[model samples]
Target chain A: MTTTSTKGQRLPQTSKRSAKAAASDKRPDEDASAGARRRQIMQEAARLFGTRGFEATTIRDIAAATGILGGSIYYHFASKEDIFVAVHGAGMEKITQAVLAAIEGVEDPWDRLEAAAVAHCNDLLGSSEVPVIVSPYYSESLKGLRETLVAQRDRYETVVADLVEALDLPPDVDRSLFRLNFLGALNWMPTWYRPSARLSPADIGRQLVQGLRPR
Target chain B: MTTTSTKGQRLPQTSKRSAKAAASDKRPDEDASAGARRRQIMQEAARLFGTRGFEATTIRDIAAATGILGGSIYYHFASKEDIFVAVHGAGMEKITQAVLAAIEGVEDPWDRLEAAAVAHCNDLLGSSEVPVIVSPYYSESLKGLRETLVAQRDRYETVVADLVEALDLPPDVDRSLFRLNFLGALNWMPTWYRPSARLSPADIGRQLVQGLRPR
Candidate 1:
């Protein structure tokens, strides 16, 4: 009888230990799922914000789009501004990374600059499904988020400026004008570019780079 | 006594005629003042809309900026939207006219295109006093205004497209891509352009057009 009682206690202890282990193993999965949910909310929010303006969109709108209750959003993000900051920050980081990576192996400054322009254009117009949120539009409504986004943009521009300066062009070439024109062309694509338009984003980028090259 | 009575009636008639002459003489001055006032209001409104956004700026804000009572704005313009539409419409017309005029005398398609680009860049970036109000950032909010503005833009692009199609380039050269890249480079200038920056808008336009020309 004593041996059986001891066996039963050990079985419960083993079962509890296994249960705890299982719960611990599920944590990363939960975290990943939670992160995905947050991302999903941000995506929906960006579309709405981009179309309807940020101040006009409510957390409930995002919640409804995600098919979650309004209160549930708070579990993932502290506020709407928090989600905006994350979306824009992630977008800038992704674009900067793509641009930086595109020019990594190129030796010629012009080639590097061209690669960076193409990569940035592709990321902005091609891969990223989100709308390009202009910082000035949201500055009043989301001040903190705007500041952070602007800083990120400045850093990205610095990278381009550095590349422009490094290029071995003719003595008469105006480096500042080159950088402005190059960036200006890329920034304007989002305004008039239609995905159904004849020129693909890559094609446009290539043509633009050709235009940017030394005469 | 009969002559005195006749003179009294004649005197009243003479005074009435004088009053009519005075009013007629003041008409051109009144028209000039009204025109000046309209321009002033539009200028103040553009400044406010550019800095604080269209929706956030109330009629009262415009009135305060112009040193007039809020209700006085209604006397000149029907509503805030009316003012915005007018300002945007006028700005677009001016820019379109400037560009079209620049391309008129130039015979070469490439030269015409370059002239148009230079004119647009100079108008947008050179004249610090002139503001580019029809940015895509505010396009969504101004739907009716945008439709008309876009139609005008389509006409402008059609002109450019026709020129591009007529260009004597190799078969492999994508004319549509070339135009897109050229306009994209020009239109995107305002986003990153700083007045205090080293390069003038015309200088940038020249480089862009030079880079775009076929080798």
Candidate 2:
């Protein structure tokens, strides 16, 4: 059987749509000003895309939301698809890094898994837009987005699988199935999780890990 | 805090789009036959809607898939939204009944809850199309779908909550969070589930309950 790997293991191929947009664009200088402007656009774009959907939110809408003229958006990004790719790519990169860092140096594999779960949940809950943008709806509209997201998602699951494999659990325990169930639980939080809800994301994460940990 | 109620607790006021479609018709006998035909259309519509999308699938597409003329679909259902409402409404009703039935004879709360989860997962797995239709995408599209689904969903959760409450676990266990984590694990199975996967749905269901049972 093929081993199920982690999110970091699988990097998605560049979408033709995104690739076309990238090829059409001229890169800005690596100066601080250019970097700041790009960051601003990505932040605003993520919010709008999460709320209104990738297809419904236009270049003009992103520009208007960011206090930049429609043409100005093109100076930083080639197209709306390009912006979407950037937002998703950057979000995954940050989340993967945080998760990897959070679990570092933890001795117990299961404890490291729990820490990763908490860190990932905190990251999702902390950012209002990431969950929405990463939701299946927006992912469906953008060609190649699902593959990219699923690949990154698989990387995260791999982290859990690796931890499970490292554990001295019962020989009968199917680590792959355990990882699938655990990840499924973690990923569905964004659907019902409201910031206004009584439970903090960290608390929820803790409970989840506690509930799923092998006896 | 307001209780997040069951999925089918309250249906929203029909949209003007659906209301107009309902109002424009006049034949009395057509109403009875229309209801039957509407059911037929919805059955077929759900399959198509589940595969594609409610918006992406046209009346003609549904008709073609159902082996009926495009105009014939109009004779039964009012519009696309009407078909959507019927498909979602009817599917939830069936699932609710199935789940309730599964738990009825079992006196043990934990067993009942396990049965309910198994029933739900099996129902979704058995009706390949219904799972997709009842997924987050379709839930997000309709104004009342999520509320309706959650209302029905709460009924299932209530069973689990009652079971969790009766358990001999420590007092510090949060029943609500327990239910949330349990339901989260079960409900999100469709996102990654492949029927051809090594574990059968029933196997996965039992393993999930085993992993999640309070220690």
Candidate 3:
């Protein structure tokens, strides 16, 4: 009975374990292959969704992209929407984690927000395998999935919202609008951002924050 | 020869004529029906493209949505891509004209930009038949169509670019980033904007511009 309780506690504590350590503890070779296969599906699905969009991409296409059998994909994800949600959630998690880490020791509200933006822009525009997948516009076909996607993204938004709330701004300024507009600028960078552009992602973030800093 | 010269000169002046006047000047019934059919096709296609996306939305789908035969669509557009280009170009034209009209008498650089943003946000968030179709991100599938889309949008970007150039920004500021980021915020509104929200589109626009105004 004591061992069962200890095991239950240990299961929830997996978050503290390094991903590799946790995987290795599972089933060694089998775990490694499954993990690698799952990652390949995710990466390929993200790429396909990024280029072809959610509706246009199919399980078959994802399987083909990852060089796996179509039937094998169902073993990983229940449906195409499930894979999309996973991709979106993963991207959001990466961004949220980066922003949280970036602002960990920062004290000043503006500075904290700036650090978050820098981390965000870098993760989003940088060569991360799972880049933040905020679309330029919301698609009508994704209407049903929007709620799920929005909920997933809300965690990151809340982090930024907290940072914005801490700012000493003019009383008339709407903090919500300020937060949205600030993030909008950062998220929209992928539309016009070029690798060869004069400004780096960090530069873009700083410039954007600088533009919004109240006199 | 003199008559031919006068007719050629008059033909180029059609820009000054009202669209209704120009339509009536053509074969009245045939031109009117043809013009209505084209407008219907454009409106329906824009909605389909907005909802279903460009690749998924076929000429047959557009024809069905417009209540015309699939074969009849070729009378208005050469292909699905041609229709996409037309919708994009039309949206750009509407936005460009609105911004131009909005800034006609405004002289202050900031004020002109504010007016442009107001017009832009209003049209983008408003019930305009052909809203600006800037995607949330550049899709990989759009690689082939990107140049055409960018060419269509450049006319409007140049208008905003010129406005940003005129601003009395600090010497360290990159005006191009300022312009892109400014438009980025305005363009991103559709993602989070709610009609039921407290702020109207114009109010949102004013707030965005106010947020960016250099202290």
Name the lDDT of candidate 1: 0.68
Question: Candidate 3 residues A2-25, lDDT tens each?
Answer: 111122222324322333554777
lDDT of 2 by residue, B63-88 (tens): 87777767666555556777776666
B86-191 in candidate 1: lDDT tens per residue? 6766676677778888888789977877788888888877763436574555535666566766675676678778867866666766776677666766766766
lDDT of each: 0.68, 0.65, 0.79
Residue A130 C-alpha lDDT in model 3: 67
Candidate 3 ranges with C-alpha deviation above 4 Å:
A1-25, A136-138, B1-26
The worst-scoring run of ten residues by lDDT in candidate 1 chain A lies at A1-10
Q: For candidate 3 chain B, which ten residues in a row score worst on lDDT? A: B1-10
Model 1 steric clash pairs: A185-B185
Candidate 3 achieves a global lDDT of 0.79
Give the least accurate 10-residue stretch of model 2 chain A, judged by summed lDDT. Answer: A1-10
Model 1 ranges with Cα > 4 A deviation: A1-26, A54-81, A101-115, A127-147, A162-168, B1-32, B55-57, B69-71, B100-115, B127-130, B155-171
DockQ of each: 0.24, 0.31, 0.45
**DockQ score for model 1, please?**
0.24
Write candidate 1's Cα lDDT for A1-215 as tens digits. Answer: 11111222223222222222434555767656665676778788877666556665778888889888776776666667877776776677677788889988899887787788788778777856554565344545676565676886787778888998897776777777677667766776777677898777877777677655645
